[model samples]
Target: MGFTNENAGYIAAQTAKRFLDAGYSVRGTVRKLASARPLLEDGLKEYSQAGKFEVVEVPDITVDGAFDEAVKDVTAIAHMASPVSFFFKDPEPVLHAAINGTKTILNSALKAGPQLQTVVYTSSITAVKSAKEPHYVYDESDWNDYAEKEVERLGKDTPGPIIYSASKVAAEKAFWAFREEKKPSFTMTAINPVFVIGPPLIAPKTESAVGETIRLIWTVFSGAPFPLPVNGFNFTVDVRDVAALMLYIASSAAGGPQAIADILRKELPETRGRIAEGNPGKGYNKEYTVPDGEIDINSEKGKALLGGWIPYEKSVVDTAKSFVGLV
Candidate 1:
């Protein structure tokens, strides 16, 4: 089962299409059968006449044994069903969900380790570093300093967004711990995407990274209540690229976690961008630039293994057009 959103779902759909085209049976897991029906119907209509798309309902990730029955008979699993939200009054729920969900999935994978050859966990750049430091650059090696985060929480001033970053850090740390202790037989890989944006496979109603990006663009151009962050920038990759990378890792005989990190390093530069397409509002003199002193994730290792990392410039343009109804 995979998480579906405008950005991620589009990529997931594309991935599913590729697999189905190769004549592999595809089953998608959804939290709600009713909400996922549209995606299922569309997949059936677009991908195949054989109705190979199957949807299995799973318990909430926060609950134990949520994936017990779901993982049965599955050769490989891509754990992508985690919380991705920035608007939270409290971080406890989001943090618990992310950490607990990962634990649940990893535990289940360990139980199914004998049959499973590989499992790809979808992580994020949020886990790698934070945008708080204006002059600091971040790369794959730079882990977010959660210790500093705790200090901030105790300080007089604390921003809610920091909670999101903290959650990612904790979850990633938990993942590594689980890996080290249990050392499951199956190979594990994690894909950490920056600001993932692309075309939507399911459409606007779906809450996805793609949809959220479009909403941000609309807020910028339409002169909404909130203004775009002038100093805010994100590393991005095309949903297609991410999906392809995930599939490659899952299917490849040689690729591993290090290989995935290598790919990310080579691809980071082309991915950084401002939240909006055009210039900032008046008096917003500061423009977002790639921070210096941060670790560069695009390394020779990534370049050698993943070939060339391609940026999705067209995907960005297409995303803008979709929001403006020009697509």
Candidate 2:
């Protein structure tokens, strides 16, 4: 239940739509209801939402009791409000916001009463294990203890990506630990998504908008050079799937950001000249140019499906269509 006037955000807006379409009355939280509500409502106009949808102001989610009133009557919750851009050199602020903001929501959920059943948190795959060089396959049993240690030893000197991974590692542990200690009746599930990219449901047409992950693709379409390592390192989950909490990625699937650049070049005419012509067929798995000592991690699709996922190409095309005029 997070939104901003300028950036309603893809996952946030889509999560709200999924709930509303499923007939749950939603009481979303916003910092400023005046501007955010109109945009959120406008974005959901396509749905014949069965239940009422409304929003309230919860100025700061990190504050204690911030969600008390907002969550009082809800049964299930999808909490994806933590920011990913807090790449501050100071880990305290990042840690505090991620950890404390998580507790604040769970605390409110605890007080929300006996009907509450599940609280799905938007966790990162980094929470499983950081994708360091010599990438390895990670299963459900792995925890990113490496990031925690690296951050601790390096302190502010730790890379921002590691710190991000560390915070998720910390926050998800904190989530499960709270459950084990407190033994709340409601179950908690953390959805760990890898590099989230897809059509942004609510991002504006402006190229400068901050929230959509697809904007990275925009940078490429605008003639920026390939913005990733020669062999791209990211595995993606669609923002909509992440929002819906329907991911089923096993430890054996492997595609990266470079795949998107290639997809865009093939699908979007506007990007034909603007995007780079990487080795085309030989890009992924380095049938073309494998980096020295690099390894690939693979994953199978998860068995469960809230319907199969949106294919990456469709996600890419729709994302490009969403920004149709901007190039």
C-alpha lDDT of candidate 2 relative to the true structure: 0.66
Local accuracy of candidate 2 as per-residue lDDT tens digits, 1-327: 222111245667777777776766666777676656544467765442433666678778789898888887678777767657535576777888788888888888889888887787777777885545564556556677788898889998987777887888888888888899889998877767766767766655677773445666666656676666423334555666766653433222244456657777878776788777766654465322233455433334442444555576776667666666676
How would you encode candidate 1's per-residue C-alpha lDDT over 92-179 as one tens digit per residue? Answer: 6767887898888888776664667777777766667544544454456767676336635644233445666777778778878888
* Every model's TM-score: 0.72, 0.84
* Stretch of 10 with least lDDT, candidate 2: 1-10
Top model by lDDT, which number?
2
lDDT, residue 303, model 1:
33
Clashing pairs in 2: 248-302, 251-298, 251-299, 252-298, 252-299, 253-298, 253-299
Candidate 1 contains a number of clashing pairs equal to 5
lDDT of 1 at 142: 65
TM-score of 1: 0.72
Question: What residue runs in model 1 are displaced by over 4 Å at the alpha carbon?
Answer: 1-23, 47-51, 131-137, 151-158, 205-210, 219-226, 230-232, 247-306, 310-312, 324-327
